[model samples]
Target: MLFVNLPVSDLARSTAFYEALGLSKNPQFSDETASCMVLSDTIFVMLLTHAKWRTFTSRPIAPATTSEVMLALSCESRAAVDAMVDAAATFGGTADVNPAQDLGFMFNRHLADPDGHVWEAMWMDMSGGGASA
Candidate 1:
């Protein structure tokens, strides 16, 4: 299983943003300070409030004002990549930091959550010959 922990300024807002992206919340590992968004059986995103996240480490938390990481997720289709970007924009997220890419057999877009974390939504085709991603 894979778990990506993100420090968020507001747990509620972050959770809502992720939910809008179509990830379901798993109440099993949620609390007032943190919530779990399940992307798949083996993939999870742990959204933690700044305060709650501090408990896990002595190092200073990376401010949401900058790009600390660029998380990438795969989409089922090229259209799905665009749909996810649209949903993200509708839910207070922004997809303007980078331009969209189309490599014939692959497509990708970048979106930033309210807290400035960037996510790349991608779709690829490996069935036959096509331009590289």
Candidate 2:
């Protein structure tokens, strides 16, 4: 809840990916070895080198080959969501293997960065009359 820490094989590459998404890093928590990405006022993402990240968790890291969890981020508008997905591609990332689907009240797309980490960009229409999640 307080923060989401992601273990990336290459810190620089991961940092670039996030930067392309319009997020900035807090220099205080960043160094040559790691980058702390500021997602919002309350949420932060600590992008750590695989080795450095392991030190903070006891469980074995999940291998992308067999298991993976896609992280979803909400956007303020449909255009914002599209822009992020486009930025990912320009930064050497890939559009979600599966195309986006519109669900009347929401529009969602998935994207994978160069390191094979998947992120979902989504937009919801609060005025569309759907119950808040």
Candidate 3:
């Protein structure tokens, strides 16, 4: 199972933002300090409040302006990639943080959540056996 733990300034707001992007909150593993957002059967995102996060690590939290990591997810279609980016923007995320990439068989767009975590929504056509440069 994949769990991406993220530090958020506001738990409720971050939970809502992720939900807007189509992930459902898994109440089974959620509490006042953190929320488990399920993206797929094996993919989960744990939104942790700054205070709760400190319990797991003593390192200073990276500010939103810093690019710590870029998380990527595959989409069913090119349209789905566009839709996700649009939804992110409508729900407090910044759209097109990076230039969109279109490699004929693949397409992707980068977006940033309210907390500045970057995500790349991508779609790829694998029937051709390999991706083109």
List TM-scores for all candidates, in order: 0.93, 0.87, 0.96
lDDT per residue as tens, model 2, 1-133 = 4677777788888898889888899999999778989988998888878788778887776665532778889999999989999999898788865689788688899888766778899998887567443
lDDT tens per residue, model 3, 1-133: 9999999999999999999999999999999999999999999999999999999999999999999999999999999999999999999999999999998888999999999999999998879845553
User: Who wins the TM-score comparison?
Assistant: 3
Clashing pairs in 2: none
**Whole-model lDDT, model 2:** 0.83
lDDT of 2 at 86: 93
Residue ranges of candidate 2 with Cα displaced over 4 Å:
131-133
**Candidate 1 pairs with clashing backbones:** none
Cα lDDT of model 1 by residue, 36-105, tens digit: 9999999999999888888998788766567888999999998899899999999988975688888889
Q: Would you list the rank order by TM-score, best first?
A: 3, 1, 2
Candidate 3 regions off by >4 Å? 129-133
**TM-score winner, 1 or 2:** 1
Worst 10 residues of 1 by lDDT: 124-133
